[model samples]
Target: MPASDDVVSHRAGLLRAPDGEALPQRVVASWQRSADYGVDLETVEPVFSGTPVTDSLFAECGQEVLSGLHRTLENEPISLMLTDADGLVLGRLSGDTSLLRALDAVHLAPGFAFSEREAGTNGLGLALADRVPSVVRAEEHYSLSLCTYTCAAVPVLDPVSGRLEGAVNITTWSRSNSDLLLALAQSAASNTSALMLARSQGRRPRPAPRGEVVRVESARLEPGSGTAHELGEAWSDAVGRAAHALAAGRVVAAVGEAGSGRATLLAQALRRARPHDRILSAAAPPPADVETWLALWAPEVGKPHTGVIVRDVDVLPAWSAPALRSLLVGRPSGAGPVGGAVVGLGGGRPGGTTAGDHPASGAGWAVTAESANALPAELAPLVDVVVEVAPLRDRVEDVMRLAEHVAHRARGRAIEFTPTARRALESCPWPGNVEQLVRAVRHAVSRTNVVDVAHLPAEVLSGSSRALTRIEAFERDEIVRCLTRPGATMKDAAAELGMSRATVYRKLGYYDLQVLRD
Candidate 1:
């Protein structure tokens, strides 16, 4: 019997037997019997409804079940009907026109009770009564209005407590029948119940924090997901190792040479990490939630700055110390300061003066010879960390080799660089100093291109000589280029040309570069 509070006044002509006989008496008798069984009949005025036992638990479970059901249907005309433990229709998913009409004929939408006592007998009602799976087809329903539909339903059991939580039923027109369909519905219901139980029992495992590991190679930054390349098995193995470390929660940082599969590795790592984890490349930063930052050190000092603006420091390696010191002291060998702050990266003492030693008086700050040298040092005292390029002997030699190769290939012809020239092309300390020599030889062999030294840009051929060659003209051109680029750096340009950054001061001394130096 329903609880007294669960009783409701029957809608005037809502119920009819299979013979079209009115069942008002039977409905009233059923309500009375439900009251006798401790069911609240009085609450039936609005219908028997109660809040879920836990916050959003029932709703979340329902949603999970519906998701699987939707996938199973896959655009097929299938309808899902959810009934409470008491066999009341709580929700329905259907797109079948005929099924909808049949359901409407019996007023069996949400809020309709299909309990054994109320609906006499049906898959939903009988299943609720017996607490088991059931199927009711045409002519099996005690109610005349429901005799045209077929439904396969199963009682959903809470895995942890082993209680009948609810029931899921798939309904269709009476004409449709397939054992496969029935089995699918039962499987979906079982899986949904398992999920609900797991959630209820708090059995879901918490995902571990991902490791902070990033590897980026010489791949050009792409607009989305960065650049991608095929990695050989060796690289792939390394990436897999990195991924395993990440999964185990380790901090790993890798420096990939250009042409390596660094970008692809990074992309894969990002994809594998939890949504909260981040993968940052030059082109993109991880989501805000991830505690990560990217440091970009350009080879050129005067090129326009992109991405985050960290502290700008002049990096002067030991090899270029004399030239750097000379430039700082105003002795220029033809090249002028490109513009921007120059932070001496490796020459400062371990605990030298802080970046704030001079206390930059303006928005931009420059790390003079007094600032720290290593990454930790520069990062320690500066608000925004930026690395300035300084040519080392190895680097200079490399650049010279590359330059000679380029010159030899041109054979003295006036050659035009497609993108003018790159800072790295101009200043990179070719670690494999003579690598470009081989490339040049190959290029000359393949294309029969004549090597031109004179046509080469003054910056590439003469290095600092270009700055001192025509100090005024160079300054004007540099200023115009900086203004055009919007965020050009003088220090960067100086480093690229293998010249002392102090030359910028001498050049600026002659002509205003219209740049705000910090």
Candidate 2:
């Protein structure tokens, strides 16, 4: 044989050495003398506690260590394994199973001991015996079954005290480079140990809070009267404390009326706290036609008007039916109004009192006052006297028809616009009733070249469809054009105009147009 082939033969011979003469035996013998002092399987097994580690610990460790190992060995023909101190396999990232089984049959499996005196001489045994890192190639293991496997293992130590924490191992076929594998395993073990140590020492910072309160202003006064300055100061202090808490890693949610000065309070709190923290206020104005008393406290409060109808009270059925349909469609409708009834709209005493009877009547405020005697505290303030309207079932068919029409149009055009249109058509308060649908359709047709739900303007998307009637007029004009064309067979008219022949016939029938010449 040539010199290069001889060297390969010699290495193969070395790997195939008998169990007693294997290199793993020598390494394990030496390691057993040092770290194994007063420690044997009998004494160690009972002391090995199996406490479950926290998920956060695992997640952090995986992020810091496992991710790196995955990236480094992604294309390499190697299998990396990490085991806990008790020899329980924690995780494994492998290249191939045939190679893994070959490694395993040689006592190179994770969680299996290959100490010289025990199972006898393997990379794992030698590394444990030496209390360091070592590599064992084919014939390097004392066990006969492990002759075809090559493995490298390193003991990870706790960074603070240098105590053995766990072991990291890399296993490959005997053809692999043993020296390189051992080096990589040792490096990975070291890095993992450092990460664990840093985590134990609280080196990692906590996640930032979700939100903060910038400012809060409130005042204490009689139940029916205005708030005082002291209350505002107290509210501001509360907001500041909340913001501070958020900065210190706490989630915070705020709720109040439109004019409750909630935004100002949140803003002030943010100014005093960390700039990185976010502050949010949920104080949306009431829908039109509903007088909002809360808007009075808003920094930008405007005169309460009756022209604006608060859909919250007026469009109960419109909202409910779509929600019910959505639920039936397997999509979540979220939480609907409690007790499955519209909140009544009235103030002071509940019984049939007009707006003129209320104390805030001159203030032009509409308060959705809860019936304190009948409702839960959280829901009480939302209860205004019931606004009568048609039942949900009466209008649901129309909304559904419109939604279906828009969806069909979207699909035919191969446009991804159904969701927005569907949502608008389904959710909007159709105050002008069916007439509104006609105008909205026309507006959508004109404004959109390719109708997509997302392209619709926000207000129109969320508004009533009273404008769709304009679209109907356009449809009518197209129908007239199709019918007046020369040799306008119903089939030709339907095909050219994108309408059903039956629909064209029905239109002709309605207009008393004779199709067959007598």
Per residue, candidate 2 scores C-alpha lDDT tens digits across 1-518 of: 11232333344355533334543334433323312222231111212224434254333453357567868677777877775543444556776777667655443453454343344445665565445577777655444455566879886655533334456778777788888998888778767765664554222222212221111222121121121213323454555554453333222222222123333333443434444322222222212211232233222222221101111111111112222222212233333222322232222332222222221111111211112232222223333332222322234544645433544454454323355455555555644343344445545555555555433323333222222233443454466556545567768878988879877766554433332211
Instruction: Give the Cα-based TM-score of candidate 1 against the true structure.
Output: 0.30
lDDT of candidate 2 vs native? 0.42
**Per-residue alpha-carbon lDDT of candidate 1 for residues 1-518, written as tens digits (9 for 90 to 100):** 34332323443245454458764332343333333334332222224344323223444576567766777575666677777776767777776677677676665667677675565546666555445466766544444456567777777755533335577777776677735546756886777775664554232222222322222222233211422223234444445554543443322222222212233443454344322333233322222212232213222222222111121112211112223222222233223222222222222322222322322111111221212333222223322222222222223333433344444444654333322233324342222223333343344334434333222222232222211323444554554344234344666666654556687655544443322222
What's the CA error at residue 404 for candidate 1, in Å? 90
TM-score of each: 0.30, 0.30
**Candidate 2: worst-modelled 10 consecutive residues by lDDT:** 306-315
